[model samples]
Target: MVDFYPLARKAEVLHVPMEVYLMFRAAGGPDILGQSAAVSLLDWFELDTEIIIVMERPSPSMDLVTYSTLHYPLPEDTVRDIMRQLVLAVIDLHNKRVFHRDLKSNNVLIQETEDGIRVRIISFGCGCIVSTIPYTSFTGCLSCAPPELFLERKYMDSPTSVWQIGGVAYELFNEDSKFFNTYEWFIDALGMKTSITASEEGKHFIQVCLEESPSKRISLEELERHPWFFTTT
Candidate 1:
């Protein structure tokens, strides 16, 4: 059995076999109500582990450290499996009318099961309800953030998670940051200066996910049916 006592003392303990922990801002607790709501939906579908809120602690100051060394290239089939799991998880969250707000590689946890790789979306500290007050500012990792998020605009309703997921997929496959690199040369190598393109199928899928117009972006349900995912053999 996984020893969760360390986590239990730090956060509220949910009654689940798997060890899960959640910590939220004391004053901003209501802002993250969507996470609890999403967790409920996952429980209904039997797809999420129970999350218990640990007691609030003073937010810690941390330094930014690039995770360039944490790369392990997986087989193509394994990558597809990870993507499938991520899509299913996101689909379930969208169906429940909750947006993750922050979706990045660090926020996602991967474990190997007897059947295959099991991916779990974690960290709901910044999540908010779909209908909550429109956010005027964005708060997330800049590397994986959508371009629109950087713009100073109120009432951003884009399904930004989709774009972040694509960034995650790119990182998984490349073992290096494509768009999220800090070095100027690395960013240039991504061919951002020119109109870089991928396969027809890849282009279609990535375009929808990275759509500049929030209204034009594809929904999770529609994304699950995209050829990039379905056509994978």
Candidate 2:
């Protein structure tokens, strides 16, 4: 997979994606859902103004946005399976000490295998090394950013990462989520809006992930254990 980014922004880009692939490979992390969740970055080099990234391209894949739009109004069980893999993918990155600050729907790729649907997280352009220190500047899609970035002007690792995961869910489950902001997210996430079609447990999972206060947001561990993942029907 070759991703093309604007030449103007090439100078500012870091090799976080490459770093993540390498680290995960070195750690020998197991695959998620019987397939490699990590998108391997073969190599990258800048040419004058633009940067060309060579990565592994999964056969017959589409981004999550396209996938979800194609399967519009995805059922809760399918959403549950997808989210389980997604959260696990996120946890895998965090475990490798990588922070994919921009974890929106567009960054995820979906592959339909003989067994089942598989998800691969792509685009580490907005990623960074995980650190205990908070990030004062945000490097992700503005509308997809978390409330802590707007409210406190700084975002820590766990809270912000968890929020981004929730943002992905919002995009999948909520109507008219394309133009959202933190304020809108604040009000809409208080509870599952009528536009969101989901079970009570699923609704609660998203609500907990998008809590207004950073302190109130769910941790990755808690998210994996969320009841929604285990709910049937």
Best by TM-score: 2
Global CA lDDT of candidate 1, please?
0.50
Identify the runs in model 1 with alpha carbons over 4 angstroms from their true place. Answer: 1-71, 155-158, 175-200
Off by over 4 Å in 2: 1-35, 175-180, 187-192
lDDT of each: 0.50, 0.74
In angstroms, give how far residue 149 of model 1 lies from its true place: 2.5
Give the alpha carbon lDDT tens digit for every residue of 1-233 in model 2: 43432222226643433443443442332332224576765556667666666667777789988998999878878888889998998888888777888887888888888888888887776777788998999887887788778878989877887887887777777765463456666575444356666789977887798787888899999999998998798
Which 10 consecutive residues of model 2 have the lowest summed lDDT?
A: 25-34
Model 2 residue 210 CA deviation in Å: 0.4
Quote each prediction's TM-score. Answer: 0.60, 0.82
Report the error of model 2 at residue 61, Å.
0.9
Error of 2 at 83 (Å): 0.7
